[model samples]
Every structure is written in C-alpha cells, then in structure tokens.
Target: MPDIVEQHGVPVLVCEADGVSIGTVQDALDHLIGAAFTGAEVVAVPSPRLDDRFFDLSTGLAGDILQKFANYRLRLVVIGDIGRHLAASSALPDLVREANRGQDIWFLPDLDALADRLGPDGAGRKTG
Candidate 1:
C-alpha cells in the first residue's frame, strides 16, 4: 500500500520502499492509476521498489513507464540512491539529469531532498 501525505502542500502518494518492485508497464500503470484515486498529484517511489530492468536503459522499460506517467499527467519522483545503476549505464545518467530538470518527473536522493526542492510549503505549484 502507498501512503498519502501532504508534502510542500501537495498531496503525494509515497510508495513503500519495501513493496513489490514495478517490473512491467502494467505495474507502473497500476501505481499511477491508484495514486490518482487518492487525488494525489505526485507519486514518490523509492528506487528499491523499481525493477532492476528499469535502470537498464536497453530494456526500454523506463521509457515506457515514464511515458505512461506523462500521458496521464502524473508527476513521478524516484527517490533513493541510484548511483550504482547510473554508474553502469552510460545513457542513464544523462536521462536522469534531463528528467530532473523537468517538472513532471524527478530523481531524488530522499524524501528530504524532495521536500527541499518542493520548498517548505509546496504551494502554487503545478502538479503535472
């Protein structure tokens, strides 16, 4: 189950770190759709809950999952260290860097970093 918490004044659905990892596009869809029902604008997923394939740029799973979130206009935040994965993939680091610059998706180190980026009171911010 995901927890719905207010971070920076935004209703965010934070996925459990020890929960099942998202191994397929359907899994990603399920999480995104479920979060929508909670009226959450952002879904914060810990890196531990992401499929290993999602970190392999060759798998295309990451792109597909991200596309689904973008199509649904849902913001996704992947929290926790992904240094090892990034170190292995040449393209992933660039992808992560680019994603971080956008508003729709972000790759952060932790919830605290997310709070800082969103500010103390995340108000007047566009969701997706």
Candidate 2:
C-alpha cells in the first residue's frame, strides 16, 4: 500500500502500483475518510498512482468521481503530467480543461501547487 502523507497541511495520497485499481480505490477512499479528509482543504491524487484503467478523462467513471467531489465540496488535485491521457482521447484535453476550470478539480504536476490551491490562497472555492 502506498503511504499517505501530509504536504503543506493537505492530504496527499500516493498510489502503490498494486493499489492502482478499482478495488484499491475504495481503500484509498476509506483511508481518506478515516484521516483528515472531512475538513481537508485539498486531496491530492498523484497521477502515477492512479489506476489509468478508470481515469479516462471522457469516461463516466472519471465524471462520477468528479461529481462526488463536487457534491462534497472537496478540492481534488490530480498531480502529474497527463500526456498519455491527452494522447488517448481527443476529448480529453477539453475534459481536463473543464475539470480544471472548477475550483474543486485541478490538474497539475507539483504537489506544492496542490497545497496552494487547497490552502488559504484558494479558500472558499467550493462547488457545492
């Protein structure tokens, strides 16, 4: 299992190679709920750790997850380069662009950027 760390006071979840699957995502969610996720300003999901199988930017799974984050008013940070995703789907760039437009969702490679987005600098930017 990938260890969970707190970066700049925000919760950052690193995905283990074996944990990058639908089943393991539940565990990640559980870990978040059990941790400081309730009041967490930012929840960073490192791209390398995510199960690419279900993270298709144009697919329902990704949409569902984003919807849930919005419903909960949670800021979700996807940390990493998404060149692969951009190559896979022609719609991915737009999808990512739209997702990032929302305060709750962001796509970036830097963990510190995630912290800033979820910190005092990006406060009160809830979707719900």
Candidate 3:
C-alpha cells in the first residue's frame, strides 16, 4: 500500500520505489482509485517502478496513463532521474518539458522537488 502523507497541506500518496510496477493503463486506474478512496490529492511514484515502456512515447502507455489521471483530476508526480531515457529520445524531452509546466503530471528529480512544487512553506495550493 502507498503511504499517505500530508505535504504542504496536500494529501499525498507516496509509492515506495519497490512497489507494484505500473506497466499498463489498468495499473494507472488502480492507483487512481486507491488515491481517491484515501482522499489523496496527489500521488508520487518512484521512477523505477514505472515500466521502461512508459518513457517511450511511441508506446502510448505514458499518454494513456497520464490522461486517465488528468481526467480524474488527480495529480501524478513521477519522482526520480530519467536522464538516461531522456537522453535516448528526442520527442520525450519535449513531452517532459510540457508535463513539467502542467498542474497534473510532473516529472521531478526527487521528493524535495515534489514538495517544492506542491508548495515550499507548508502551504499547498488548493487542488480542485
């Protein structure tokens, strides 16, 4: 189970690095429902837990999963270094750049970054 923690006043579900791998759209829905039931406004998933295919934009897995999360108004943060994968693809960097600027899905370097994005001084932005 994901550990629910309050970050900057936001209910966040922090997924362990070794938790269930998110390899399919169903997996994304499962996580979304879990977060919803727990009253979590955000979910932080370790990058290692994401399937390698997730970084490959050609697979459509990333778009599908992210779209589901966005549709549900759930914020998803992918935490970890995806430097190698970013180095492997040209289009992916563009995707990451765009996602980082959004309110829903974010690709961050660490938990600290997630906290910062949510809010730095323990006052989180209202998630609606």
Q: Write down the lDDT of every candidate, Cα atoms only.
A: 0.84, 0.60, 0.83
Candidate 2: where is the Cα deviation over 4 Å?
1-28, 31-38, 116-128
Where model 1 places Cα greater than 4 Å from the true spot, the runs are 120-124
lDDT (10s digit) by residue, model 3, range 5-122? 8887888888889877889999878764465567888888999989999999999999999888878778888899999999999999999998887777889999998888888643
User: After TM-score superposition, what is the CA distance of residue 50 in candidate 2 from its true location, in Å?
Assistant: 1.9
Task: Please list the residue runs of candidate 3 whose C-alpha ends up more than 4 Å from where it truly belongs after superposition.
Answer: 120-128
Backbone clashes for every candidate come to 1, 0, 0
Give the Cα-based TM-score of candidate 2 against the true structure: 0.66
Instruction: Report the poorest 10 consecutive residues by lDDT, candidate 1.
Output: 119-128
Question: Which lDDT tens digits does candidate 1 get at residues 71-117?
Answer: 88788899999999999999999999998877778999999878777
TM-score of each: 0.90, 0.66, 0.90
RMSD vs true structure, all candidates: 2.4, 4.0, 2.2
